[model samples]
Target: MLWETPFGHYYGDNRENNGNYFANDISNFYEELIKKCNFRIGEGFYVNILKNYLSILKEDSEYLYYFKIKPLISILECEQYLKLSPNKEVRDLYLECLNECSSLYNKYMNVAR
Candidate 1:
């Protein structure tokens, strides 16, 4: 099952009823699990979740910024956001695309400013 939040979605097998954990905490737990176990399940699950999220966001004006510009700000604000990821190589490629989006946003903002 999945729980939706302002940040993202959280998932668990049978523990889906546990409403105690915050979304970030759940994400961190999975990240740590992947790091420790090199578990394909955790990584694959999160990747699928993220892809689904991006697809949904792509159709929404409010959230398209997240899949587009905000992820770059996330990296520039904290490289560890993706640099410390277990899937660092894939995340790095995502960061590159985010950087390009960031640049375009900057240019757009400058013109508007």
Candidate 2:
């Protein structure tokens, strides 16, 4: 599967040796679970990949610059706005994503402005 981000695009194969990995399928499953929580989400489940994607951009760094975090901040802003939607379920789902995003930032990608 291919994962694209603001930084770059990554190409990876699920077929490693003799085993066939179903990572994207598993991701789709999570995506569905999270999507069920939000009625208005456009991109489906986006909860699991941001950190891993960013880590690909900076393997050795424990922190990233504020400028380099525009993508994350944009997602955070969207989550905040989504939390205000009339749909209670979407708001709750956005809240869940927001909380998890915050935790990820605090743990792995401390922004240095």
Model 1 RMSD in angstroms: 12.2
Which tens-of-lDDT digit does each residue in 1-113 have in candidate 1? 55555445545664745555565566886677546434432545645644543444344344234445565345345433444455764465445545554555655576667
The TM-score of predicted model 2 comes to 0.33
RMSD of each: 12.2, 14.6
Give a tens-digit lDDT track for model 2, residues 1-113. 45532323344663362122345555565565555435544554433343343443343334444345657657666544454455565566556555544554665544533
User: Candidate 2 at residue 28, lDDT?
Assistant: 61
Compared with the true structure, the alpha-carbon lDDT of candidate 2 equals 0.49
TM-score of decoy 1? 0.33
Whole-model lDDT per candidate: 0.51, 0.49
Give candidate 2 misplaced runs (Cα > 4 Å): 1-73, 109-113
Instruction: Show pairs that collide, candidate 2.
Output: none
